[model samples]
Every structure is written in structure tokens, then in C-alpha cells.
Target: MNSITHYLHNELPRINAFLEAQTARLDPVVRPAAEHVLGAGGKRLRPLLALVAARALGCTADPYPMACSLELLHSATLLHDDILDAAVMRRGRAATHVEFGRTGTILAGDVLLALANRLVADYDIPRLNAVLSEAILRTVTGEVMEIANVRNTAMSEERYYEIITGKTAYLFQGACECGAILAGCGAATERAAHDYGLNLGIAFQLVDDALDYVSPSEITGKPSGGDLREGKMTLPLILYLRTLPPDARQKLETRIAQDDLDAEAARAIADRVAASGCAEATRDAARGYATLAAQALEAFPASPERDLMADMLDLVLSRNK
Candidate 1:
């Protein structure tokens, strides 16, 4: 295996352990449900980013608590998001709400969110908790925006970016910022970390949106054309719109605005978006952000940790699932 993959293998188990161990202090009733979501498989991307950020900045203190906070925050979002989206599967398993019931899953997610904040609070760095809290607030706001804009015909590219930056990028930005803060890095370096994470997070979401149109169910652990059926206008569909003639664009917009689109109709439109090369266009946009993310790392001097973090950009851009 390549170095990045090898490194990921080395770190994944350690972070997974940290994620599980954090739940031990929770009330027993909520503990099992919390553990269930935590145990459900994931790449643990947010936590790993924090750990790597701390290492890159030459941190001496243990970073696991801070690192794990990102995962807890992210997991909590997943639990709540699955419910909001009415999703049936996550990480190739039944969604937490499906197995645990919606109320239990929601409570479990809320507990985990609190636990995440508590972990940061224990650090005694008021800024760390502030950073995490802002991320949570922004993330939730993004979700609300996304929900509000469903089937919205006038959704502009600028507006989409605004929503996604909150929906995905802020948490990523917060993760790196917390990592840098924990390392006691200078303000300039901390800014660099923030830029890198913000751009990378945008790229990550763009790719996910692109994949929604093309990836098979097994690959994404979700239904094909799920976004289209749900009336969510993603980057691929948005880009595809710009290429159509006036009448066709109007028709497509009307279709997107439909209160209910069946599977066949959703699949058909998704296929057209894929075949028109808009998915690739979305990926190309992702590459631009990925490049920016790489440049952000240049603010720091060379080190194995820095190089590993840079490699993560390539990994994010290359994700097909």
C-alpha cells in the first residue's frame, strides 16, 4: 500500500478506540445507542484531520480528546441528518433511527453533541469550546438552509456555496483550527490551517454531490439519485442547468420543483446530468478547492505530518464513493 493508505490504517484503529471510550461516561440508557452509532463504520475523517493538524504543528500534549471531539460532533450530525433526510442506510447498515427508533436516536445524538462540547471544555481552553460551538451552530444553520431551499428554482451558485460552507466546511475548518490551537501555533499558522480545512471541506461536499448522481447504491450506501428524488439541487444539477437552452432549463427547473418525483423520473434526470458531463464538472470544481487546500499547507514548513495532510487532498478528490 501507499504511504497515505498505510498511515490511515495505522491511525484508524486508534481513533476508533478513542471514539468508543468517550461514551463510557454517558448515562446507561443513552450509552448503548450512542455506542451503536459510534461503532457504525466510518472513515473518521474529521478526527484524523485534527490529529494530523496537531502533529503537523508539533504538539506535545495528547490530542486524542480534541481529535475525538470532531468525530462525536460529526456522528451527532449524522444521527440527526439521517432522520431529517429519512435515510434508510448509513455506513452500509440500517440508519440509527431505523434500528433504535427516532426519539432514542435523537436523544443519543444530543447526548453525543453535549459530550463533544464537554470534551473541549475539559481542555480549559475557552477558545477551543468557542470554535467547536460555532461549528455546531453553523452546521445546523446550513442544514436548515438546505431544507428551506429544497426544490428552490432560483438557487444560485453563490447561494449554494454559502449553504455548503456551513453545512460541511465549517466543521472541517473548526477541526483544523482546534488542532492548530491545541498545538499553540501562531495566529498566522492557525489561519492557514483554517483555510486549508475550509477549502477541503467544500471539495469534499462537491464530490459527494457529484457522486449522488452516478454512484451505485452499494457504493454510497444510499439510493441512486437520492438527492434528485428529494428535490435537492446539487452542484452537478446546478451546473447542468447552466448548459441547457431556455425551454429545457425551465422544464428541468419545474421538474426539480415538483413536490414528488418517482424513482424512474429521478433516475432519468440523474442519468442525464451524469451523461452531460456535469458530474465531471463538479469534480473539476472540487479539484480547484483541493488545490487551494494544498496551498494552505505551504504556510507550514515541511514535515511528515504536513506531507500526510497534503496527501489527504488527493484522497478527498479521488473519492468515488
Candidate 2:
């Protein structure tokens, strides 16, 4: 396994233990649903970021609770998002809503959110609760905004950035900030870590959008053209639409506006977007964000932890490429 995967494998058991111990005290009905969602596999990127950021701040304290809190918050968001998007699959299996039913999934997600805040409240770290609370609110708002923009062909680049920053980057920023807070780091260090995670998160999402256009269904664990099928306006399609001649743009828009998207037509549009260099443009933007993320770490003293964080930024781009 790669470094991140290896870290997760080693640390997640401890985090899971912590979660189990805490949730054991909760109401019986809520426990099973929370456990089910928690046990559902994920990349655990937010939690890993929390742990790494703590380490980067020169702390040796166990980051298990903090990491677990981050993971809980992330998982809650995923549950809610899958329900809102009507996403059928998650981690190559039925989504939480698909398997548990919509109301059950919503309840599960709410439980996770409450559990995450409860975990945060247990931490003795000053201001951590306020930061995490704000982050969660922002993330929810971002999701709502994105959902509102869905299928709106007139979505602009600026609006897309706003949605992505809120939906993804804020949680990452909160993870790093919480890490630094727990580690008793100074404000400057906390801000640096926040910037690092924020930029990395943006880059990660950009690459994810790119992957939707290019990666095989098996590798991506979703059908190819999933974004197009859902009529979600992503970076590549947005850029591609701008580059097209007037008539060509009209035809593409008409196809996209259809309720039942034709797979062949979607594939053809993806091919045209690829041929038009929009994917490359989107990639360039991702690289720029990766560079910014690396630059955010310059304040920290040179160490393996710092290097790993920088490597993670590169990994974000490399994964989708």
C-alpha cells in the first residue's frame, strides 16, 4: 500500500476503537446505524490530514480522537450528499441511502454529525469546537449551493469555485486547524496548516472532476460520464462549452438539457471536450492549486512530516493523471 493507505491501516484501528468506546454509551437504536456507516470504507483523507497536521506541528500526542472526529464529520457529509445527489453507489457498493432508505440514511447522517461534535467537545483544545462548528455549517451551505446549481447550464466558473471551496475545502481546512489546535500550535502554524489542506482539497476535487471525464468505470467505481448523466456542470465541461463555436455550443447545450441523457451523446461530448483541450486546462488549474498547497508548507521546518504533506499535494494530481 502507499504511504497514506499504510498510515490509515495502522491508525484507523485505534480510531475505530475510540469511536466504538464512545458510541457504546449512546442510544441503542442510533448505535447500529452510526456503526454501519462508520464501518463503511473510505479513503479517510480528512482524518489522515488531521493526524499528519498534528505531527507536523511537532506534537507526539495520540491524534486518534481528533482524527476520528474528522472522519465522522466527513462520513456524515457523504451520507447526506449521497441522499441529495441520489447517488446509487459509494465505495463501489450501494450508497447509504440506497441500502438503508432515505429517511434512515438522513437519521444516520444526523447521528454522525452529532457524534462528531460530541467528540470535538470532549477535546480540551481551546476554540476547536467553534472552528469545527463553523466548518460544518459552511460545508452544508456549499452542498446546498451546489445542488441548487445542478443542471443549471448557465453556471459560471466563479460560482463553481464558491461551491467547491465550501463543499470540500472548508472541511479540510477545519481538519488541519483542529490538528494544530489539539497540538497547541501557534496561530500562524494553524493558519499555514489550514491553507495547506484547503489548497490540497481544491486540487483533489479538480482532479476528481477530471477523472470523471477520463477514468474507466471499473477504476473510478462509477459509470463513465456520471457527471454528464447527472447534468452536473464541472470544470472540464464548463471550460469546453466556452471554447466551442456558437452553433456547436448550442447543440451541446441542447443535448445536456435533456432529461434522459444518451450515453453515446455524452461520450461524444466528452470526446469533443478532450479534443478541445479543456481537460488540459482543468489539469493546469489543478497543478496550480497543488503548487499553492506546497507553498503553504514553507513556513514549517523541513522534516519528513512536511515532506509527506508536500508529497500528498503531488499525489492529489498524480492520482487522477
Candidate 3:
């Protein structure tokens, strides 16, 4: 594995240990489902970020509890998200809701969320609870907004930004902020880390949306056109729809709303979006956010940890999976 991957691998074990320790105390009925979903390996990006941010701020103590807390919160959100999206697959396996049934998955998610709160309860850090509580609320609001706009056929770019920022970026911001809080960093440094994560999260989601249109099934671990089938509005489609002739746009809208798009139609739409420069535009926008993320690290002292954080921003920009 590369350096970042190696670092993540080392850190994740500690995070997982804490998670297991916490989950072990949960009700027996829900514990199995929670473990099943948690054991399904993920990138563990949020927890990793917590560790990275803490290290960048010169923290040398164990970050495991904070990391575990962030992961549990993230896992909880994913469980709920899978149900909301009716997502059938997660991490190359059946989604928790599909595997355990919706009610079971919901309870498991709730259990994980409660575990996260328990992990943070003893932290004794200023603003920690306030930040976490707000992050949770914002994440739910973002999901609700996205659901409300699904299949609307007229969702605006502004609305899309609002949804993604709230749903995805807030948690990332919280993770980084939690790291800074644990490190006892100054408010400015804490805010900078939060900004870095927020921008990185937005960029990450944009790349995910782009890949949903272009990546193969094996690479994405999900079927191509799944987003289209769900009537979800993404950046590429929204930008392309704006540039199409009125009649073509209308037809495309009807097809998308009805989820009637075939592979050929999906490809045609992707090609048109690429040809119209919207894909490039979307990529440029992601790059801009990545740039901001990198800039957010300027206040930190020069160190390997800081450089790795910057490199992570680049990785986010270029990642295909």
C-alpha cells in the first residue's frame, strides 16, 4: 500500500477497536446487524480525516475514540441513506436495509448513532457536543432537501449545492472540527480544518456524481445509471439540461422522471453533457474547491502530516473509485 493507505490501515485498526468495544455493549438483538454493516469495509475517510487533522495540529495522543465516534456517525448516516435511496448495494455487497430489512437497518443505524453519542459524552471538549448535534441536524436536512427535489425535473444548481453541502460536507466538517477540538487547537485553526473538510467533501461528492455517469460497474461498485433510475438530480445532468434545446430538454426530463433511460440513452446524454463542456465545467468547479481545501492548510506548520492532508485533497480530485 501507498503511504496514505498505509497510514489509514494503521489508524483504522484503532478506530475499529474502539467501535467494537462500544458496540459490544449494545442490545444483543441489534448488535449483529450493526456489526454486519460496520464490518463491510469502507474507505473510512471520515475517521482517517479526524486522525490526520489531529496529527497535523501536533497531537500525539490516541485519537481512537474521536475516530470511532466519527465513523459511527458516518455509518449511521450511511444506513439511513441506503434506506432513503432504496440503495440495494453498499461496499460491493447488499445494502444493510436490503440484507437485514428496513426496520432492522433503521434500528441498527439508531444504535450506531447512540454509540457515537456515548463515545463523545466523556470528551470534555468545548463546543464538541454543540458541533456534533448541529452536524447531525444539518445532515438530515440535506437528505430531506435532496429527497424533496428528486424527480422534480427542474431542480436548480443552487438547490443541488445546498443539498450536497448540508448532507455531505457538514459531517466532514464535524469530523475535522472534532479532531481540532481534541487537539485543543485555537478557534482559527479549528475553523480552517473544518473549511478544508467541507470543501473536500463537496469535491468528493461532485466526483462521485461524475463517476456515476462514467465509471464501470466493477469500479463504482454500483450499476451505471442508478442515479438516473432513482430520478436523482446531479451536477452533470443539471448542467447539460440547461444547455439543451427546449424540446430535447423536455424529452430528457420526461425520460428521467419515468426512469425509462436505457444504456444507449444514458450514454447519449453523457456524451452531450461532455460535448457541451458541462462535465469539464463541473470538473473545474471541483478543482476550485480542492484548491480551497489546500489553501485551508496554509496556517498549519510545515510537516509530513500537513503535506499528506494536502495530498489527500489531490487524491480526492483525481479519484475514480
Candidate 4:
């Protein structure tokens, strides 16, 4: 685990440098907004998966530029999502939309999307282009579905899975699949890469949802229970609701419908979720996905990159933020 951590610590900066260069290409007026968001660092999990996948397949390609492009797309999504969620903080800093006005932030996001497309266009691989485009399309569809379902406390577990899988998991799947494709791996190996990333991504998001209830704002990069405050029904809350008796469930639903979603209300709801044992339930589901993610590596030979991915699965399941 320490070795894998060291490798990631060394490699992430290269990706960061690549991102810095890519964002530099934007107009000076738009550059600050893009740079601000880019500079606010994240786990960079999607791009890391790409690099690891390429390495696991023994590909000689640099993989950095392609990996960086995926990060650009992800940052763009975060910019848009903050606006949609009316969020103020991101990565412990003001959200791009909060720092830059809505119009400017929107343009910044568009610039990122355009730059991402431009980067892949330079690769001139039709299949790579298709994978990126499909990922974006699926992510957008999932966002729209989530927006349409806002405040729907009755949102089913099945629907929640569909939303998170499409919005989050598919992008990770595309990144790993594209990485394997760049490595010129066999079809079976490419399928394994996709599966590994897909399951990892699901586990990642599940942990993120769990963190929202248990982690502090300093760690989570946003306020605790922000999902519930935004009326987004995540798995913990959904499962917690199921545990309630009919009248208790109705009262909780009524409480959720109350206006303002003040701090007191958020904490109250979070307390209920904690006492109901739903956080543990959500973690168990995340463990299931992590197991699937680990299994996906069975087809690949033993390598530092593969071992790094195995360690990452543990990190995802155990992460508090």
C-alpha cells in the first residue's frame, strides 16, 4: 500500500502539469476561472485509473495526456454540478460558480468540454472519441434524471443505482476502457479494464455519499448532509427511510419537506440516519462493489499497477471523505 501510494504521489503531479498546460490554452479572460477549479485538487481517480490500466496492460504510451483530458471533463462536470446543487464550496474552496459568475462559470465549463474534445481529436482514434462522447452523453443523461427526481424521497434503490451508475460509473468505465484501447490490449482484457473501473467508480460514489453524513465539512469538501439538504435521496437516507414504521416514515418525510433545510434540520435528519444503521448498510453495498472491482483484475497479470488498484479498492471502502 505504501509503494502504491508513493507511485500515485509521484504520478499525479505529472497529470496536474498536463492539466495546467491544457488550461493555459484558454483565453486570458476565461483562464482564471478554469485554473481556479483545476488548481483545487481532487483525488484524480478517473485519470489515475487510465494510467494504471495502460500500465497493467504493458502499454508504452505516455497515457498522461489522455488521462489529463478525462480530468478536464470531470472538472467541467463539477463546475456545472455545483451550480445545479447551489453549492458554495468545492475541494475546500469556493465553487467555480460561486467564485465566477454563472455565465462565466458556464463558459469555463464549456471551454473544458471543448478542450477535452480537442485533446482526443489530436489522438485521431475514432474509437477513443466514441468512448469519450458516449461517457459524456451518459453522464448528462444521468444528471438530467437526477434533476428531474429532486426532492423525491420515495426514489427507489433501483433508480438510485441507475443514476449513480450512469453519471459516475460509466465515466470511469470509459476512462479505463479507453486506456486499455490505447495500450492495444486484447478485447477480453479491455473488457476487464472497463469492469474494474466501473465497479471502482460505484464504490467511490457510495463512499462519497456515506461521507456526506459522517464526515465533517473540512474533510468532505462540503457541508455534512448536503445531499439531504439539497433533497437528493442517497442510499443511506433511502435505506434509513425503509427502516422506519409507517407513521415515523411519514413524519420524517414531512420533516424533509419543510422549507429552508436549515442546519438544525440537516443535523436532525443525519442523526436519524446514523441511529438507523443505514450508514453501515451503505458501506456494505460499497464493499460489494469493491469486491467486484477487485475481481475484475483477475484477468490481468500481477504488476505494481494492478496491486495499486487493489489497494485503491480498500481506500475507497474505508475513506471518510
- Please write out the lDDT profile of model 2 over residues 159-268, one tens digit for every residue: 99888889998898898888888888788988888888888888888888888888767777777777888888999999988888999888778778765577776777
**Candidate 4 structure lDDT:** 0.87
lDDT by residue (tens digit), candidate 4, 1-321: 686679878988898989998888889888999999999998888888888888888988778878888999999998899999899999998998888899899899999999988888787888889989998998988888888878887789999988998789888988899899889988899889889989988988888888788888888888888888888888999998888899998887777766457877897788778777898888899999999988998988898888888998998888877
- Give the TM-score of each candidate: 0.97, 0.92, 0.94, 0.97
Write candidate 1's Cα lDDT for 68-97 as tens digits.
999999999999999999988888888999
The segments of candidate 3 whose C-alpha lies over 4 angstroms from its true place after superposition are 262-277
Q: Least lDDT summed over 10 consecutive residues: which range in candidate 3? A: 266-275
Ranking by TM-score: 4, 1, 3, 2
Best by lDDT: 1
Q: Go through the candidates in order and give each one's C-alpha lDDT.
A: 0.89, 0.81, 0.83, 0.87
Candidate 1 residues lying further than 4 Å off, grouped into runs, are: none
lDDT of 3 by residue, 134-215 (tens): 8889999999999999988888889999999988888888888888888888889998988988999899888888877777
**List of clashing residue pairs for candidate 2:** none
Error of 4 at 52 (Å): 0.8
lDDT of 4 at 72: 91
